[model samples]
Target: MACLSKSSTFSKTFGLRNLLNLTHLLKIIHRMFYK
Candidate 1:
């Protein structure tokens, strides 16, 4: 049970970081278009 919970939390954090990266990429794309 403990191991399962740990893996779940790890995945959650990983997904959050992925989402942040995606947003950061989108922002860069928008800037490129505007320029």
Candidate 2:
């Protein structure tokens, strides 16, 4: 954490958020498909 630059850390966390959102979206799609 301390080793990273602010912008780099921000982008990293932002990417993680995107990944989480993608997973959540996939779950929703799966539910829709099953239904």
Candidate 3:
């Protein structure tokens, strides 16, 4: 049970990291187009 929770937590953190990376990429793209 403990291992399960740890895996779940790790998955959530990884998902957030991916989302942040995606957001950063989008911002870069938007700046390039606007500029």
How many clashes in each structure?
0, 0, 0
C-alpha lDDT of candidate 1 relative to the true structure: 1.00
Name the lDDT value of residue 8 in candidate 3.
100
Candidate 1, superposed: residue stretches over 4 Å from native: none
Question: On residues 1-35, what C-alpha lDDT tens digit does candidate 3 reach at each position?
Answer: 99999999999999999999999999999999999
Return the lDDT, model 3, position 20.
100
Q: Output the better candidate (1/2) by lDDT.
A: 1
Segments in model 3 whose C-alpha atoms lie over 4 Å from true places:
none
lDDT of 1 by residue, 1-35 (tens): 99999999999999999999999999999999999
Candidate 2: the clashing residue pairs are none
lDDT of 2 by residue, 1-35 (tens): 56568889899999999999999999999999999
Candidate 1 lDDT for residue 23? 100
Candidate-wise lDDT, in order: 1.00, 0.94, 1.00
Candidate 2's error at 12, in angstroms? 0.5
Local error of candidate 3 at residue 26 (angstroms): 0.3
Worst 10 residues of 2 by lDDT: 1-10
Candidate 2: deviation at residue 10, Å?
0.1
> How many Å off is the CA of 7 in candidate 1?
0.4
